[model samples]
Target: MKGLMVKDLRLLFSQKKTWLMYIMLCLMMSFSMQGAFIVGYTVMLAGVIGISTISYDQADNGMPFLLTLPTDRKGYVREKYLLCLLMEACGAAVGIILCEVTSLVKNGSGVPADDIRSAVVVIPVMLILVSFMAPINLKYGAEKARLVMMIAYGIIGAITASAVVLMQDIMPDLGHSALVKIKVFFDETLGGTYFWTVPVVLTVLSLAVMYVSYRISVRIVSNKEY
Candidate 1:
């Protein structure tokens, strides 16, 4: 697992100029885009770059050679998730720093509370996105994964929108009552600190989804001839 991680990290960082360009792009965007947008953009870049390592591994019949190493399918999936999460962390840190620096330059103050909230919110969101990408890439290979991802995201968006619309229409009274009770429970239990429960829940949910994705990827890779 450690060897796989090192190999992937080296593959990612081998192109120093590409990373420098990515940093430059982020720096430029920080001046023009919303701070929250910059955060999402940087983290998305990190996730995509991390996913690209799988392509490199798949290229030139490299999978057979990689499997010949100490790692197995499960270890490979675990390493991919770990490497992607690490890159996302690095990206988020870079983004927050840039947002802070830009805010200071613009108004001589730190980032706004809303921006800070958005920045923190992007972490689990990006993790979930990476989780989905990993399994799709593992199943479809890098070339087909982009198409699969687009379709999957489209389906998810449609379903989410439909659910929101249906919820608004169906059992509105019951839903409102349930929501009220839930809010009351949170307010009674966590009081003012209930606001943080969202992120904590999201983090746990994302980790669970990532673990499931990892298991699926292991199955996909394990069954493949290579």
Candidate 2:
């Protein structure tokens, strides 16, 4: 398993697509520091980076070659999922660093430690999305999986837009009362007492998703005749 993982990492790093992604991530991080665009740029860059890693296998017909080695099919599937998790973690770390540096440069002071907490929330959600998508790719291959993902993205965007519109319409009547209630809820329920739980819960969920994805990928790959 360790040997196969090392080989997969080697292949991942050696690919030009991987480095291209890294460069693009760095550029996005630089722009994201501008404060006008915070979450959008970071989330988009992370998504592209995750999808590009999955595409690497399809582009090179890597599976048949991978099967030529002594490793089991299950190991290959597991390695892919693990690699995605690592990539997401790395991307999140890079984003955090870039955000801090950008805040310092623009504001003449670092980003508040509290606001940094909000930015980190996206990392786990990104992992969950990637975890869910990995098995889809492993079972469906790149072309079909890309279509599925595109549709999913569209649905999420539409939902978000609708929710924003509804909120804008409702906000006039709710006025300061709604804002006060939200503040009180956050202060009472979501304050420092439960802040640490977000990452803990997300980590646990990501692990569960990773495990299920591994099993499903193994089943799909095992049935294939290489």
Candidate 3:
């Protein structure tokens, strides 16, 4: 598995695509995008980076050629998931750093620490999304994966916008009210260390999603001809 991971990472870094992404990410330093948006965008790009390896593998009958080695289908799937995790983590970290760097450059001050810290939650969100994407990519190859990701990204964006609009209508001050509610619920109602447990719960739930995604990917790959 280590060898498989190393191979994927080597292939990932070897591509000019990876550096092209880095250059694009760095260019965001002048944009006014906040930490959360930056984090989400980076995580998405990272997952796509991992998926690009699949395309490369498919180009010359690479999947069959890879299995010709000592690895099995399960190991290959596991390595892909691991690769996704690693790359997404890197992407999120880079996003956070870029957000801070950009904020410093523009305002001479850092971003809201709360917003920056909350970016960790986006990591799990991206992981789950990537996990969901993996099976489709594995089954269909790179071109379809690109198409699917584009569609998914659009759907998610639309849903997010609609949700924001709905919330604003539901309560004009929903944002402030929700913050107050959270403060009361966590700080006052739960108190002590329980407030921090929300993140733990979210992490566990995200892991569940990732696990299900892994199982689905395994099934998809196992049934594949290659």
TM-score of each model, in listed order: 0.84, 0.74, 0.75
Between candidates 2 and 3, name the one with more favorable TM-score.
Answer: 3
Name the runs in model 2 displaced over 4 angstroms. Answer: 15-25, 28-51, 154-183
**Model 1 misplacement above 4 A:** 161-192
| CA lDDT for candidate 3 | 0.77
Ranking by TM-score: 1, 3, 2
Candidate 1 lDDT, 1-226, residue by residue in tens? 9889889888888999998999899988988876567777878888889889999999897998999999778888888888988888888888888888987887788887656665677778989988888888888888899899889889999999998789879866777888899878866786566667766788789989988888888899888887
Against the true structure, what is every candidate's RMSD? 3.1, 4.2, 4.2
Error of 2 at 110 (Å): 1.7
Residue-wise lDDT of candidate 2 within 24-66, one digit each (tens)? 7666656655542354346545555555555676666876876
- Please provide the root mean square deviation of candidate 3 (C-alpha atoms, Å): 4.2
* lDDT against the true structure, each candidate: 0.84, 0.70, 0.77
Give the worst 10-residue stretch by lDDT in candidate 3: 27-36
Positional deviation of residue 27's Cα in model 1 after best superposition, in angstroms: 0.5
Superposed Cα deviation of residue 188, candidate 3 (Å): 6.3
Q: Could you tell which candidate, 1 or 2, scores higher by TM-score?
A: 1
Alpha-carbon shift of residue 30 in model 2 (angstroms):
3.3
